[model samples]
Target: MATANTAPNPAQDTLALVGRILIAYLFIPAGIGKLMGFGGTVGYITSAGLPMPEVAAAIAIIVELGLGIALLLGFKTRWTAIVMAIFTVATALFFHKYWSAPEAMKMMQQINFNKNIAIAGGLLALAAFGPGRFSIDKR
Candidate 1:
């Protein structure tokens, strides 16, 4: 019978660190952008045809910024990651779908939307597996 004496794999530890960093880094700029209202984020939300655009903008900013901070600090990582994953999906569908974009911009919009979906998938994985021992949860 195999005993539980397996040595820790440094490669996996490194990969986990990379994954944590990648996922965490992606949210930082987005959160900052929403918090600072950079690139006319509020106006863009209004242009996206959502009802009560300002309210939507505020909610988005709060969720993105708040959850992002939680994720960065590794606090409540599972819940934060799940919330971020859902937010990413919704944002991709509502904001990046680009149904009305011109031909030249359609490709870029599609790529951007798909990229968000991929990011959401990564967040979901993190939510399921957690941030490992290096995180606040430490599960």
Candidate 2:
């Protein structure tokens, strides 16, 4: 029988740390931006045909800011990553919806849709592999 290699790789740890930071960079400012314009965000969500736009906006902020911060700090990283992965998919479906976009906007929306999927893939990887040795979760 073959055994799995359970050893830690220093290079992999460094890469994971960098990946976590890069992913946080993608979301933290977005969350902060939403908070800075709460009403505007709620309006945008309302336009998406979502129910309870205000409450949905608040939950989005919490997931983006709270989970983004958690990922940055490497706190409860696996769970945070999983949450982020789901959030990314929901946002892609609700906000992007490239298939329904008008012709000119279709390309732009499709780009965003793909971007969210890519981000979700990264988040899933983080969920599966964890935050690595440099993280608070490791301490």
Highest TM-score among the candidates is held by which one?
A: 2
C-alpha displacement of 29 in model 1, angstroms? 1.7
Off by over 4 Å in 1: 1-14, 98-100
How much does candidate 1 score in TM-score?
0.82
Query: Model 1: per-residue lDDT, tens digit, 1-139?
Result: 2125853355654455567677778777776787686448778887888898777777777777777767766678888888888989999999787677888889899999999999898888778766655656654
TM-score of each: 0.82, 0.95
lDDT at position 63, candidate 1 = 70
The 0-to-1 C-alpha lDDT of every candidate, in the order given, reads 0.76, 0.92
lDDT of 2 at 67: 88
Query: Over the stretch 59-125, how does candidate 2's per-residue lDDT look in tens digits?
Result: 9889888889999989999999999999999999999988999999999999999999999999999
